[model samples]
Target: MKKLLFTSLLLVSSTEAFAKDITVTLEVPSMDCATCPITVEKALERVKGVKEVDVTFENKLAVVIFDDEVTSPDALTKATENAGFPSRIKS
Candidate 1:
């Protein structure tokens, strides 16, 4: 029983170890209107594993927090692009 419990704990920890939260800033130069930020925000929020999304029309920047184990920065960019606002990783 002790060995089984230990193995279960190890497996749980190992799975959780792969889940990493990452925050990235994307520059969306095409957001030119007041409603653009809203659109961008909604698009990013639809991506799986995206924890949070903040888009600013004034600066044309989208800040996104997501789980690396489930998604990636490339997927984030693609989401915005599909929403009609192409974006790139902020340098």
Candidate 2:
């Protein structure tokens, strides 16, 4: 019984190893001020599985790295939008 429990725990933890980390660049065209990047970055950081976020007001871009199994690009965009800065995936 102990061995079976240990195997189950290992299997559950190993699922995360199969999750891919994806990096996405989003264009936040409405960020017209320096503080805009701060807000955008904060919003992204609040998202689950978000590993990193880099927002630049000068380029109006947000680079995000997150676990694909926990979140998605669409969810990232929605986060910025909810913060009042709408964004889209860069082409």
Q: List the residue pairs that clash in candidate 2.
A: none
Candidate 2 lDDT, 1-61, residue by residue in tens: 9999999999988996799899999999999988989999999999999999999988999
- Name the runs in model 2 displaced over 4 angstroms: 1-13
lDDT of candidate 1 over 5-70, digit per residue (tens): 999999999999988899999999999999999988999999999999989888899999999998
- TM-score of model 2 vs. true structure: 0.86
- Give the C-alpha lDDT of model 1: 0.95
- Score each candidate by Cα lDDT: 0.95, 0.96
Each model's total of backbone clashes? 0, 0
Top candidate on TM-score is 1
